[model samples]
Target: MPPDALALYATVILLLPMACFFLSSPTFLLVGLEIPEVTQLLRGLFNGYFIVMCVAGVASAVAYVISGRPVFAVGALAVAAVAVMARRWFLQHMDVELQARAAGEAAAVPRLRALHLKGMLLNGILLATVIANVPLVV
Candidate 1:
């Protein structure tokens, strides 16, 4: 795929889990795996959330196609939904981590911070790309 399309795919993939991660669980799939157990489990648990994201994307794409213009809004909403949910979840988790830090569990704080940054960066990029594509429209 071209870099643009690849980025779009990445955005879609990120959204679903992000939403679910916030609403329910932190489990997710990494690129590589020993047994793929964690990945499979997370995917299984959040499958409905993923479906909702994809459906939202497709619906937005349909509207864009009908209008004969690119609307990054579709992608943007998807990303935002995910980010909102993920952030909510992250904040909740962060509270726990904060307490742990107070208790001198420094190790978990760094790891959680890393994960938070990673999620924020990824979602931010996805949202930006969606907006950038608006002029090009679909």
Candidate 2:
């Protein structure tokens, strides 16, 4: 691909996750409000967000590689891996805890909250990493 095209691709890839991060941040904060219906809706939204992250990460890595920037490709792949981990492990466990809490297991509430906090922290880190890579890749 031409240099200009590659730059555009890189910019789009970077922007995808940045957009997702900004949009999802508010939902993360609202997780603590303890509205079951809203929480359920947010859970579905987060699932979509994580999937988008993974796809965008892979796309960014591939674009970087095609653009002859292997280091940026690796960084992008790392961000994708983090998203996969959050989706497969953190989110999965959070769902389990939520179910348990719903079943009247009071102890699960704190655990669920902790997991939510961890998810938010991970998301912040991922957003920062992606933002930092934008200039390097683009």
lDDT of each: 0.49, 0.72
Best by TM-score: 2
Off by over 4 Å in 1: 1-71, 131-135
Q: Report the lDDT tens digits of candidate 2 across residue range 1-138.
A: 685478568757756665765676566565562557766766676677788888888887888788877787787788788778778886688688778878888787677667666766777777776667566654
| Candidate 2, pairs of clashing residues | none
RMSD of each: 12.3, 2.4
Candidate 2 ranges beyond 4 A from true positions: 31-33
Clash list (residue pairs), candidate 1? 70-137, 70-138
Provide TM-scores for the models. Answer: 0.41, 0.80
lDDT of 2 at 1: 67
